[model samples]
Target: MIAEATEMLLSHLVLFVLVLTRLSTLLMAMPAVGVGVPKRVRALLAITLSVLLLPTISNDLTSSTLPQIDNLIELLVAVAREALVGMLIGTVVQLLITGMQLAGELISSTGGMQLGDALDPTTRANMPALARMIGMLVTTVFIGLGGHRYMLAALMDSFQTMAPGNVILHQGMMDLVLHELSVGMSAGIRLAAPVLTALLLTNLVTGFISRTLPGLNVLAIGLNINAMAMLAVTAMAIGGASWIFSAELDVVFERIARLW
Candidate 1:
């Protein structure tokens, strides 16, 4: 009786560790959950989430159809596979979040502001101030809309669909990633289109004034006008930008589901 109980306990412990490998890897790759968060806190969160999800996935471990871990080598392989699956999903979500930063690049380009760089608190990376601000705004919207909740849900569902040690890598996965990246890039351009257009018009008017009044310091005047125009255009177009981000955030989870 004692031997049987010890065997069962070992099996459950092994299963829990396998599940944690994936969850911990995922938390390490995600933005708010990983980038800005302290390592200890992220680890605690991953462990907490793993415990919560263990019951739901426990049946998976007991299934006869599940892959057998015959030795230490097999267990290591399973751990690696699970980590890859989690990181893959996290990368896709990170790509979506970068759309806002791309839009900021577009807006800053016209103002000659993209050249100046600063440290971003969230990512701890150096980027233009406008890009940093937009990234923060998108992060705010992501949290506000419960995007993190949806992200966690999708991650949970992946285990049921993909299963640990069974993630298949195929051409379709690459195609999906490419398609999502294209969508993210297009979203950035669309979000910044209004501001870009306004900046273009501002440049043209400045050029016309410079030509008409050659004695004026056209360079100085144009710089001031571009700054003012960028501010105005940003204020006017923030609503549309938010809508684009929200729409893209919705699509990210759907794509993640299909990828697995």
Candidate 2:
């Protein structure tokens, strides 16, 4: 009887490890949770989530479908597959935030804000102030809109379909990722279009002024006008930007659900 109980406890322990692997990988890739979050805290959250999720994962498994943890090679393969699944989900959701940051980079390049580049604590990289600001704004909006909750729901549902040791890396998943990438790029361009247009017009007017009035300091005046135009257009378009991001985020979540 004691041996049977020991075997049961060992099986549960192995399942917990697998659940933790997937959860930790997913959480580490998430922008809201991973970025600027301490490693120790993330570890604790992963462990806590694993403990909570283990029972559900176990219930979902059948005796025949349980991963062959007794075999070292099979166990490693299962862990690897779980990590891949976690990364796929995380990457898909992260694309939305990347698109917003891309928009900010475009605006900065066109509006002379690139000069204010600084190290962003969240990303731990040098980024234009505008880009960093927009990244932070989108992240805040994501949390506010309960995107993180939706993300977790999607992860949970994925397990209902994609069990450990059964996550197949198929062409469909690759296509989905590529589609998200293209969408992100296009979305960035669309978000920055207004500012880009305003800056273009500002440049044209400044050029015409310089040609007609060679004595005027067109360079200095144009710089100030460009800055003002960028600020003004961005302020007016902020709401629209948020709307677009929110819509795109919804689409992202839907795609994840459909794929998984």
Candidate 3:
């Protein structure tokens, strides 16, 4: 009886580690949860999540051996596969967020704020002030709308459909990713179109005024006018931006679910 209990304990331990590997990888790339979170806190969250998910994962491990390898080579290969799957899941969500940031970049470039770009904490890269604000705004909305919960649920579902040790980079996944890239670009354009249009009109007006009054410094006035127009247009378009971002995020979950 003791030997049987020991064997069961070992099996659970192995399954727990494998589950933890995937969870940790996914959480590392997750927005809001991964980038700024402390290592210790992230580790605790991964462990806690692993334990909670163990019940669902246990059934899949029944046929596999505890070591599941004849040597270290096979073990490393398995680990790489698990990490790849986790990374792929994270990448899908990241692409949607990237689209929102791209819209901000467009707005900033139109408004002349791209020159005033600074390092953004969220992405740890130099980004325009407007772009940073938009990224943060979208991220806040995503978290507030239970995006994290949906991602967790999706991870669980992936295990049931894809199963541990069965993940692969197949053509279907590639097609989905390509489609999403197109969607992201479309979303960025839609979000920035209103502001861009306003800026274009402002430029035309400034050019006409320059032609009418050659003495006036169009360069000096055009920049400020463009900046103001950008602010006004962005404020008016913010509601639509939010709707677009939310809609894209919803699609992210849908595509991820079909990955299996």
Candidate 4:
């Protein structure tokens, strides 16, 4: 009984090591949990969670001893495959957040608010204050909408559908990710359109004023008018941001759920 128990423990350990490789890779590349985090911390967290998950996911991998190969080359290849799969999924999610940042940039550009910047605590990088604000706002909405739980649920379900030994790249999923990226960029453009339109109209009016009022310093006057116009439009747009967020979140979740 003692020998049998020891053998079972060893088998579990082996399975855990394999499962951990994939989880670590995902945690390293995925957004929110991955970006700007210390590598050691990500590794520690991944190993700890993978250890907890091993028993649940072990069936997805081979329990039998590894087959003979040219040294450890094949084993390394398997590990690489697991890591690649994890990164692929994680990157898709990361790009989604990048889409949000791009939206922030477009707003800042059109609003004549690009001069403002702030340090982002979440990303630990210097970003436009507006961008940082939108980022934190999005993260808050994500939590409020229970998106994090869904992410974890997706991560857990992946083990069942994509075990270690049978790992294969899904080209169809990559295409879907590409489609989502393009859609996200378009959404950003749409979100910034109203403000941009207001700016354009303001410019046209300023140009006419310059031509008619020869005594006035039009360039100086136009700058202040542009600023005020942007402020007004931004305030108006903000009231509708929640609806935009809800619609965008629905699409994001729909795309994420299809990975399995």
Candidate 5:
């Protein structure tokens, strides 16, 4: 009877570990729940959530049904797989901001602001102020869209539809993720398009001013106009694009779970 009881305990352990791994992975990588928060806090949150979820999950679906040693190995693999998926999702979200950052850099370069650089508090990386602005703006919209809640819902549903023990990720999932990458890059370029267009126009107008009016300081005027134009465009875009962009934030996160 003692040996049987020990076996039952081991089975439950395996299942709990599998779910714990999934929860931990999501917490570690998902926005708001991931890096922005402290590690200890996140762990505590994961634990609370896991306990709440454990009762609802069946023994057959968890470590509770497995023998002790088998449960341990399965639990390890299950947690690691969940972590891999969480990391993948998290990386996609991070790249979206990086895309915006790159666009800002391009705009800066064109506006003759290539020498400028600064530290970004959120990313703890050296980034131009313009890039930081663009990245921060998008991140704000992501939060405003309730992206964190949506991510959790998607995660919970994913377990229901696809059990943790299966450990199977279809190839089509990569293709879908790639599609998100394309969408993110496209959005970044679109946000910076006006600035880029205005910059090009500035160069044209400045060249003509320099050629036609040699006495004027074309570079100085060009610098001021470039700065003013970028500011104006960003301000205008932010006003209208905030809602549209925020909607996409939810879509991007959902793609991970909903897509093939």
Candidate 6:
């Protein structure tokens, strides 16, 4: 009886470690939860989530379902597989934010906002003010729209469908990632289109004015005009930007669901 109990405890412990590995990787890859969060806090959250998810995961981990991990090397391999699965899911969700940041970069360049670059805490790099603002706005909107919850739901679903240690690294997965990346790039361009158009027109008019009044300091004036135009157009198009981001997010989540 004691031997049986010992075996059971070991099995449960292994399961817990696997669960914790996946959750830790997921959180680390996640944008809002991972970036800027302290290690201690993230670790605590991972532990708590692993504990909460263990019971459900236990039901799915029968002898037939669980991978054979006879030794430490095999266990490590299983853990690595689980980590990959978690990273894939988190990366899929992160693509939306990446697209939005791309839009910000375009807008900032067009509007000459690159001079106002600031240190982005999340990325630990210098980014244009507009790019940072747009990134934060999209992140706020994502959280406000319950995107994090949907993300968690998808993670939970992955466990049931993909199952830990059962990850199949295939060409299809690579294709899916490439397709999502292209979609994100196109979405970013589309999001910046209105602002780009407005900025283009503003520059043209500024150029014409400079030609008409060569004595005027048109360089300085044109800069101010471009800034104002960008701000105005962005304000007018903020709603549409949010709508596009939300739609893209839905598409990303749907693709993630189909991965299993």
Q: Using Cα atoms with residue i matched to residue i, what is each candidate's TM-score against the true structure?
A: 0.91, 0.94, 0.91, 0.81, 0.85, 0.93
Candidate 1 Cα RMSD (Å):
2.1
**Residue pairs of candidate 4 with colliding backbone atoms:** none
- For each candidate in the order shown, give its overall lDDT on alpha carbons: 0.79, 0.83, 0.80, 0.68, 0.70, 0.82
Give the C-alpha miss distance for residue 102 in model 4, angstroms. Answer: 1.7
At residue 74, candidate 4 shows an lDDT of 66
**lDDT by residue for model 4 (1-260), tens:** 99989877765654566678778877776556775578788888887888788766765456443222234676687778777766666666555555666666876776667778777664677677766665666656666777656656667776677665456677866786797687667665666677778888999999999899978999888888888987788777754445566577677657666766
TM-score, candidate 3, is: 0.91
> lDDT score of model 3?
0.80
**What does the lDDT read for residue 77 in candidate 5?**
67
Ranking by TM-score: 2, 6, 3, 1, 5, 4
Per-prediction tally of clashes: 0, 0, 0, 0, 7, 0
Candidate 6 per-residue lDDT, tens place, 1-260, comes to: 99989878887788888888888988897877888689999999999999999899888777777654679998888899888778877776677677777888999888888788898876788888777777778888888889878878888987887666665676766776787788878878888999999999999999999999999999899999998999999898766767878888888888878877
**TM-score of model 2 (CA atoms):** 0.94
Task: Supply the global lDDT for candidate 1.
Answer: 0.79
Model 3: per-residue lDDT, tens digit, 147-230?
Answer: 889888888887776666555567877777777778877887898999999999999999999999999989999998998999
Q: If both were scored by lDDT, which would come out higher, candidate 1 or candidate 5?
A: 1
TM-score of 1: 0.91
Provide the global lDDT of candidate 5 against the true structure: 0.70
Model 3 spans with C-alpha error above 4 angstroms: 1-7, 64-67
In model 6, the runs with Cα more than 4 Å from the true position are: none
Q: Which 10-residue span in candidate 4 carries the lowest summed lDDT? A: 62-71
Instruction: Count backbone clashes in candidate 6.
Output: 0
Alpha-carbon error at 110 in model 4, in Å? 3.0
Model 5 over residues 234-257: C-alpha lDDT tens digits?
676655446546656667766766
Lowest-sum lDDT 10-residue window in model 6: 163-172
